[model samples]
Target: MSNPDITTPVRRPRRLRTSQVMRDFVAETHLDPAQFVLPAFIAEGIDAPREISAMPGVYQHTETSLLKAAEEAVAAGVGSIDLFGVPTPEHKDASGSQAWAADGILNKGVAALRREFGDDLIVMADTCLDEFTDHGHCGVLTTDNWGHTVVDNDATLPLYATMAVSQARAGAHVVSPSGMMDGQIRVIRDALDAEGFEDVAILAYSAKYAGAFYGPFREAVGSTLQGDRKTYQQDPRNARESIMEVQLDIEEGADMVMVKPAMPYLDVLRQVADMSTVPVAAYQVSGEYAMITAAAQNGWISREPAILDSLTGIRRAGADIILTYWATEAAQLLA
Candidate 1:
């Protein structure tokens, strides 16, 4: 009795963690592969996947390789695959006309994926101009009387609408508008409906910010952006304004909304999750992935736990879906 009295007096919490089975049973949060969506980049006419040096383990897939990757994602139980296109430099232009071209690489990828998987996997297209634009700003650019570069909001809306309908026609289950242009959702929704694509959904990047976290993404997409996106994307300083952006997009007919660079803006995520009537998604953007991979490569931290922890943290902060470069790897880990 005297020997046991010491342990009883301390009321040790270690009892709950004494066994793996017990720990599993008491776990409050669980990661599922089905909640993850892999973001894949496809370039035109490449024979092999082109690895991005900065982002370890990620690549720009050829159409053939993209289909294979999609199959792998489906096999791994990933819920969806988000597609982006890296056009041949010759195809890029001031207006990013390739974005809405039915025969563009992204559209071709969509059609091929639809043929391969049909409705088995949720196929999403990134309906933005950055990847296709020569200048790499999200929208069409113009100049003021003083020749200052400006993003013409009204002028860019219809192009987004066209891109949305084109993506829908190519068999994308969702059109994700990451351009951050005003009234883009309304324009896209109207365009989709008018084109008889009533079933296609809009996944709006409602709370995207002009943050440094997008550096790796710019490189991933081969972006040529010369300046910042502060004029269009949300300011990082204001959380309350993000709610307005989300609300406006929802009112404009967004089916789902996303918060970019998930970890840093989790407070924003929580606020968006609480206020939104629809599902919430979070993007563990390129920089976030690069940082973790870099640390793991340097042996600064254990990779598996860090990956799981990062995703779990996103989920815990109220993301129903997570768009991550680590989606496939994390899904495999879960499996």
Candidate 2:
């Protein structure tokens, strides 16, 4: 006998990977349709759906198209739909007042989705003001004594609170506050409770970083941002800071927490997921979608496999829920 240990390989890990069925059987992390959340944009005055140039397959939907998209998402068994409003340029204002209006695009979208799906689907509203504000900042801006124009954190809280209440009244099951305003969770939570919407849940964007990856998103929302949102959004260099942010949100009554731009910050997502008492979500942001789509289009990579692989990587990194533009298509594939 020629060294039995080395001759035939004593431990053949390949046994489990021998076939598709075998590999599926032994897989540690499995994806489900329920784990996906779709981010959708509804433009206020669009006559029809218009495809976003940067994000190849994604579109800025009109009301009709938005409904159709939701129908398709429901058919594909997507877990949730997070709606972002794109108001006409005329609606943009200093206070982002449209964000809290009952007739606002986001609130109306939420209402329509809820009416169509009833209790069958979870409707989420993006409770942020970036798309509505003329200045394109996430919050109210004022000149500090130093002559620097900065977001007024205290002033922004009440707006967020009111926006949350508006979303709740519009039948949203969850209101996601993507603005990184301090005390936002507590303020929104109290506002909801006081309005008898105690059962409404909050999904706090606890680790949204100010990064270059948001370019495609800015296009989709028709953003009017003059400068960067560096002061409020987390810096990309800081990972430990995300943990503190998550802790604060949880302590302040966040029902769930999220890490935005999932691919670039998988480490932060993993850390947040590991320490979080509630569910953790990761957003596969617009830029990530655009890059992957562009690369696949250029024949640099296979699209379907790349999509599945990216989602799997996020899932393996401990994301309980993933927000992505590919949610419906990925869910259909997984199903």
Candidate 3:
């Protein structure tokens, strides 16, 4: 009987992972609070923070609570915050007038954060109609020749341009257009430049997908969605299309490009990161947060570690920035 000697080898991969210090030293990916972007909600009539049921520990905030959260995020070293508005049903119109109004909750929230933090924080606004529109669509709707209601892409572009200008005026350093409308970035960029807000950057949601993963977000925003966004948002089945979308956004002057629903679209994230000339971002959407939180609350997993690991995995997948509900907590944990 013969046996080969296996104790000695030409290489020892485990040597670097043998200890915590060793692992830290040899780590290829490192996460920083500055690489995280938190998305916050501002409700029109709310006087206090309202917790979202599906997303544990997340809230639809009032002006006061939104400012406090912004301050806390800064203290925790989180890089930026993205704001979404929840207007009352009475205020919503077919045009989503509140979205571009200077006094809109999201606009007011951005202004307050800018006033408080000045240049210390990066303030961002979601320049989309879904949160403000009665129909819960991302754009203006019109009847097509077939007598079917559809998003009027060209007509919506002007509204997006106006919303971007308003957000810039409200002190948002970045205006994220997540409507997935064609040529949205170009119209927005043109509008910003014309309004002398050339410094305000456009963060385009280039590869956002239509999926079940967005269910929790509807609740968080108080959405009255009647149907699916599948016609506008990218189909989950396409990968090559993501590259085309990212490229078009870049050419249209997007300062940053993003892939939405980070967990499921990680491959898309990687492709966008590789293809894009601008910084790449991945959104850990509401459903992703809800799933993890639900599992943790059920005692199936350790909450804090899972959060950190999820963010770390996204970072390792080539996302330059991660937009997550757990941004502040993760930043604090990383500290």
lDDT of each: 0.92, 0.94, 0.92
User: How displaced is residue 83 in candidate 1, in Å?
Assistant: 0.3
**Model 1 lDDT, full chain set:** 0.92
Superior by TM-score: candidate 1 or candidate 2: 2
Looking at model 3, the pairs that clash are none
Each prediction's TM-score against the native? 0.96, 0.98, 0.97
Q: Quickly count the clashes in candidate 3.
A: 0
Better of 1 and 2 by lDDT: 2
Give lDDT tens digits, candidate 2, residues 109-142. Answer: 8999999898778999999999999999999999
Query: Candidate 3 on 262-312: residue-level lDDT in tens?
Result: 999888888877778889999999998998898998999999999988998
Deviation of model 2 at 72, angstroms:
0.7
